[model samples]
Structure formats: C-alpha cells, structure tokens
Target: MSATVQTPTTRPQIPVTVLTGYLGAGKTTLLNRLLTEEHGKRYAVIVNEFGEIGIDNELVVDADEEVFEMNNGCICCTVRGDLIRIIGNLLKRKGTFDAILIETTGLADPAPVAQTFFVDEEVRAVAKLDSIVTVVDAKNVVARLNDSHEAAEQIAFADVILLNKADLVPAAELVALETRLRTINPTAIIHRTERCMISPTEILDRRAFDLDRILAIEPDFLGEDAHEHDDAVTSVALRETQPIDVNRFNQWIGTLLREKGLSILRSKGILDLKGSPNRFIFQGVHMLMEGDDGKPWGQDEARDSKLVFIGRDLDAVELKAGFAACVA
Candidate 1:
C-alpha cells in the first residue's frame, strides 16, 4: 500500500511591524491603543515582558530573550532562530491574525530586528517585515537620544516615528526637535501625537523591507552598508557624571570632527553643563552637529552625560580622554 501527501499551498505573507522606542517613550501606551482601537485587524504582539496589555487573549506572547544582548541594547543575534520557531508554531493557528507586531525592549536597535525578517529562511518565507514604527517622547527624547545610542539607531531604522507627548513642548521647540530628528534619520516619516494617538494605517504594512522602499529611503540599509559591527564598523559608549564645560566641549568636538569626522559616522549625547540648570543635548552625523538646551534638570534628577560613537577604527582611549578633558 502507498500513501500520498500534499504540501500546504503558500499564502500571502503576513505583514510584521516592529514597535520600538526609548524607555518611557510611550511604546506600551501605543500598543495598548493599537489593541483597543477599532482597526478591525487582529494582531499578534510579542514583547519582552507581560504587563498592562488589558485584553485577555492569546494574541500576546512574552518574548523569552534567548538571544544575546548587544551593548547598545539590540537583540538581533538569535532572534530569527527564536522567531522562526515561535512564528512557525503560531502558524499552526493560522487565520487567527491579520498581522504581527514585535515590541522590543526600549533600548533595542531595530537594525537587527529588521534583518531577521530578510535573512531567516522560514521567517521571510511566511512573513514580511512590514515596517519599523518608532515612538519618540517629545519632552524626554533629547535626554534619551543623548544617553542611549539605541535611541538614535531606532530613529535611523524607522519607517514611521510617532512623536508622542507633543503637548508637553511648545510648537517652536517641537518643530526644532523634528528638524534634528530628520537630520539624524532623513528617511523616517514623522507623526506628532499626544498620548500615543495615531491612525493604524500610517504605520502598518508600509513594506519597509521591500527593495524599492529601502532603495527609496536609504540604499545602504540592505547590503554591505548594513553595519554588523565587524572590524570595519564598530561602536563604543562612554558615560560620565561630571558636568561638561559647554565651550570646552564644543572646542573639543570641533577639533575631533576636523580630525576624525569621516571615521565618525554617528555621535550622540546629553551633556550636564557645569553652570546650567537645563540639560544640553547634542548629536552628530559625520561632521554635521547640532545641539540645543533641553528640559531643566529636575530638582532631584541625576546629572550624568552619556555619549555613544559608531564609526571606523575609533581610538577609545584618546576619544575618552579628549571627552573627559571637556568636563568641569
């Protein structure tokens, strides 16, 4: 006796959107809104921890970070392997969800997340990496961007950015902030909001990973240009508690840029100025740098400056000492 089996016919791949932002940048709030909103499309959300989802259903799964963590807070290493196992398992219950949403930890970099969908054999075969929707906190973004390189990387990789908590800042400041964000990531579409409110259509199914879309946004996102932090491209983070001398810091940065700008691809920081009540924030792309005064330090806020550098062959000791020289 002989038996014949038929393989399941392939269907249109499910769209996937990655939700990311700095801590307290309103991701969970936005996820809550997305779930509660009347979008009519069922969603599967994967997160690092389970909390405050409200809706009681199997749509949400807590992500077990079997993947390794990078210094900048990205979990892309083994995520494809994990997702392949999880999503493949989720497929057994096919027809239950129209799309999938992955909410990585606030400090995560979306590059690795996006890469998983493009390279994983089983994952890409069944699911498409739709877009990366990053949430930015209007009031606190300056500090967060200055302190976390992941924040900058998030903006760099986003197809859409929900600039939430817009009501907290003035229109002029918001405009200025948007301009700076654009300079850092020229490709992202920015949407201003209060309390994470926005239309679902704006972020979902953007096909950010499509070759045409990627070429339109930034051609380097897919090929050898994608930085894996190998020998040619590397990253480092520096932290200090002492307030920096604004003028001295500027001079030091200017000289560094003049000397090493080409090798320095991205630089970002939130500085504690010796005499200022407000935090001084700044970020740079190559030789271009911009900065502005940020929210005043709270009565009890900790005053620490964090700086991250991603570039080619950066001399950590020299750079660290030069930065330290700017301290008061």
Candidate 2:
C-alpha cells in the first residue's frame, strides 16, 4: 500500500470590523441588529461606552465572550488597549467565535483603532482589519461635520458609510449629505439605512482600506509632508526602540488625558514592554485608557513601540516628551 501524505491547512486569520460615528449616530442600534441576525458566523462584539451605564441587552449569547463592554466612557481613549486584551482572550478560546465587531463611541474617531491592527505585530498575526464602517446621522451630519474634527475623520476613514436615520431627513437633504461625503471620501460604499438595519454580510470582508485609495486621497503617504494637516486637525506617528515602563506610561497617559482630553481626538499605541516579552496594546479617545497583553515576541522581531495620535492642534514637542518619559 502506498503511504498517504496530507498537507496541513492553515486557517485564515479572523477579520475585525470597526463601527464608528458620532454620539447618538445609531451605532448601538446597528450592533443590536447584527447581534440578532442569523448570519451563520458567530461574532464577538466589543462595545466601548463613554458612560457608566452598561449595555442592557437580553439577546446577547455567551454574554462574557460574546459581548465585551468597555465602561470607560471614553471610547477613543480606552478602546485600543481593551481591544487587544479582549481579542487576545478570545483567541485563547479559538473556534468558539468567527469574527470580531468593535463598536466605537459615536463621537470617536476610527483611525486609531483601524491602525491598531496594522501597527501591532501580535495583533496583525491574530486578526486582520476588514473594514471601518462609519454610521452617520443623516439629520445632523452636516452640523456635526462643521462642528467637530472627530466627525470629519470618522467619515474620512470609513470604508463603508452607513447614513443611518435617513428617515429623519428629507430626500433632498439626504442627497446633499451623500454628495458631501463623496467629496470627503470619494470611494467609500455608501448605504442608506433606516433604524440602522442592514445585512451584516454587506459590510463584512469588504477590504475597504486599499493602499491605492489612501494614496489617491492623500497622495503624500511617504513624503516628508505626509504628517502635515490643515488647522484644527492632524495625525502624528511616534516610534521608539526601548520598552516602556508600563506604570509610568499609564500615569503619564492618565494625566495627559485628564488635562488635555478635549483636544486629543484619538490616541493608540502598540508598546514593547519593559522586562516583559509580550507586547502591550493600548488606545484611547479623550480621557479613557484600555490595554492588554498580546502574543509573545518572535526571535526575529524588533522590539519597538509605535503610537499614532490624531487630534486638533496637538503640540508634537510636548506629546513626544510625554512618551519619552515612559521609556525604559
């Protein structure tokens, strides 16, 4: 008898979809819809709330594993670290879940969270970033965009723009909102949703963050002027080779957020920890912090920490100094 040889099959990494928008933009409503739908794939949802009230849902199955609520009240501030920890924990019970859906606070920017999947080696290995779905309130979108940088970035980074609460606006108004969104993000797939009801399948696995598209939008991804931005809003990337003193970093971050949270739109970091082989992941919005341990370091890996901050009129010098103080 001839011996049979079998090749091992490698499972594809699960994709994580980030849902973001301004406060009261119907993120929770959309999440609730997804949770109830019979989509064949089991999902692990991470909902970051900006207040102390927990999500009071009765339909959630496997409550602990299926629904994770970051009660930090600052979605952008605390979600990145919470995400890493939650995802890491979920991975340990592999096969129990199929995908991850993170719902950012309504007034939060989604870029920092989206960047987390790419910047963190351990995170990248375990999960792939699928898409950023921004739920826009049709009735208030124009005013929100005019009033907040967070609103603008949420729309700008979206792979899929869900113009939720479309019924609240007139047909003409909705059309105008669509046009404005196109002007900001010409390539995003736009969907008009009533009461935040849409097929989950429509949003999943849609590799929306195409590098070519981003380049087309910015046209300066690699140039020295890439970090430059208009008044009120900017994006900055910070990097270091040394591990961070986690406790000091936390204290510094806490103080920084408390003092300047209103100015900072979003902040996220993939830290190389001092004396620890595992990477520490953290993300925050204004005054919230969430973090957790990631996978072990590989021998060929470079131990470095990289963080990205997106905000309004951020003083780079002071921001860099604060990070330097955390260095081991």
Candidate 3:
C-alpha cells in the first residue's frame, strides 16, 4: 500500500531590523523614510532616546514602549537592557505588527544588538534578526571611522550600509568612503542615498549575516586559546557536550556582565540545559543579556553547547572557567 505524504508548512517569522549609526549619522532620517514610505508592510518602531524629551512624536507609529532614555547618551551602552525587555514584550503582541525596526542611539555598536536575536530565547523564538543596517554619514565617514570604535564596528558588522547624506560629499570623497568600508567589510551591500532615502526593498530581508562570515571575521573565535585583535578586541568560543546548570549559568552571566560590561562587546551561545529538551539560547551586548528556548531536539540532534564571545581584551582562561562553572 502506498502512503500519502503531507507537505511541511513554513510559517515565516517577522524579522527585526536594528538601525544603528553614529550620532547625527541620519539614523532618524532613514527611520522616518521607512515610516512614511508607501510600502504596505506595517512596522512597530522601538525608539531608544538619550534624553527625557522625546522630540519625534509625529514620526512614531505606535509607542509600544516609553522612550527608554539612557544616561550615557549612547543607546548600546545605556538602553541595551531596555531593548531586550521591550523586544520580549513586543513578542507577546505578535499579531499587532508585521515587523519590528529598532533605532539605536548614535555611538552604539551593532554587534551587541545583533547578538540579542541569537541569545535571548524568547526574543529569538518570536523575532528573527533580519539585518543590521548601518547608516553612515558620507561627509563625516572618515572622521567618525577614525574617532569611534563603535562607528567602525557598525560598519564592520553591517549587512547593509547606507552612505547617507551623499549629496554633502564630493563624488571622489564618497568613492573613497566606499573603498574604506569595503576594506572593513567586503560583503555588505552598499547603498548611497541622499537624506537617507532609499527603497525599503533594498534594506529588508537581505539575510546579510551568516555564521561562516562571522567566523571568518574572527578566525580565532573557534580556537581554544584567546586571541586579541586590534583595538583590544578579543574572541573566544566554548563548546561542550555536557548540559549546563540553569542557576549557575544565570549567576555567571550576571556577574560577568556587571564586572566587564564595558569590555564585553558581544556574547552568544546555544546551550544544552539539564532538564530542557529544547536548546537554550543566550546572547548579550555589554550589560544586556537575553535568552530563550530554541527548537526542540530531534532524535538525531547533537546535544552540545557552543558559545562564542567577542569583546575587548577578554581573558580566555577566566571565561572558560566561568563557563565551566555552569556545567551540570
């Protein structure tokens, strides 16, 4: 007797795009462009502001979360924790919006924010990270790139880069900026826009990030020893076949972030938990940490935990030991 086969259905999750750039780098303008665009997709905007006064009330589509004002004037530094919480809450109201666009403050690096999609279990389950779209100010690209590590990383990790305010720069200068950006990241799709205006299709669902690309960017990431790069950046990856103690893992994460938040740029992992059949995901940028349950394990799935850390001058020995403490 022949058996009938049922086709698998694909339920596509909405993607969340994190828009970041240096201060006054046209992030807001690009956001406004997205909001006002005639495109049919509805987006729920999460605005992280530096000051208590919210000036762009007219631009906000729906104020789901109060503008989380950070003390440091940098969204990555001050509002990262708030971002995790907001995203978690947003996931609960999944039917209300088609997609999510998070506008980070200038001076914020995109790595930590991107890490959230991989680490936080709840956020990961509901929202897939679509892209890290960095808007570069064409006129001041050289200066910002020279002065800020955050600016450089934003460009480095971006899947799509918008050279905004292109009209302000000469053609030759813009070309030079493109060359510089290529050296930092050769794979990102570059778009030159005037006043941060570009087609929405150009930015969304680009699938710019890949594990292989990330590993290539930090080759020593998977190595056993700690490797430090320029600007005191370091990467370490931990892998284990054993499960982790949930309580110990939570404590270690809190302590590590509290003490080394400034130095820790990004950390993420798929964890094997003692009592959980599904994979547990953990991710953080600076002080913000988020995790959630991942897909269920199949009969042939490998039960192992793999975590990667990228930061400034991180001590590999100490990190490994701390992670080991979480072992069950």
TM-scores of all predicted structures? 0.60, 0.56, 0.57
Q: Give the higher-lDDT candidate: 1 or 2.
A: 1
Error of 1 at 172 (Å): 0.9
- Cα lDDT for residue 223, candidate 1: 35
Summarize candidate 3's per-residue lDDT along 178-198 as a digit string, tens digits. Answer: 766654554467899998889
Q: Please give the ranking of all candidate structures by lDDT, highest first, separated by commas.
A: 1, 3, 2
Candidate 3 residue 296 Cα shift, in angstroms, is 23
Ranking by TM-score: 1, 3, 2
Best by TM-score: 1
lDDT of 1 at 156: 66
Which regions in candidate 1 have their CA more than 4 angstroms from the true location?
1-7, 50-58, 68-80, 208-328
Candidate 1: lDDT over CA atoms?
A: 0.70
Each candidate structure's count of clashing pairs = 1, 13, 6
RMSD of 2: 10.6
At residue 312, what lDDT does model 1 achieve? Answer: 59
Q: Please, what is the whole-model Cα lDDT of each candidate in the order they appear?
A: 0.70, 0.69, 0.69
**Using lDDT as the measure, which candidate wins?**
1
Model 2 per-residue lDDT tens digits across residues 1-328 = 7697543345568888888887788887777777778878778777664522344443222212122234433433323655666777778776777888877766665645764664456787789877888998898887887778778788766778999999888999887677666655544679999988899877887863332232233312224433332334555556677889988898888888778866665566678889988877666555554677866788898778877665666776888888988997
**lDDT per residue as tens, model 1, 124-238:** 6888777779999999887876666777777766768999999999999998787666555544678999998887777787752321221233212223433332234455556
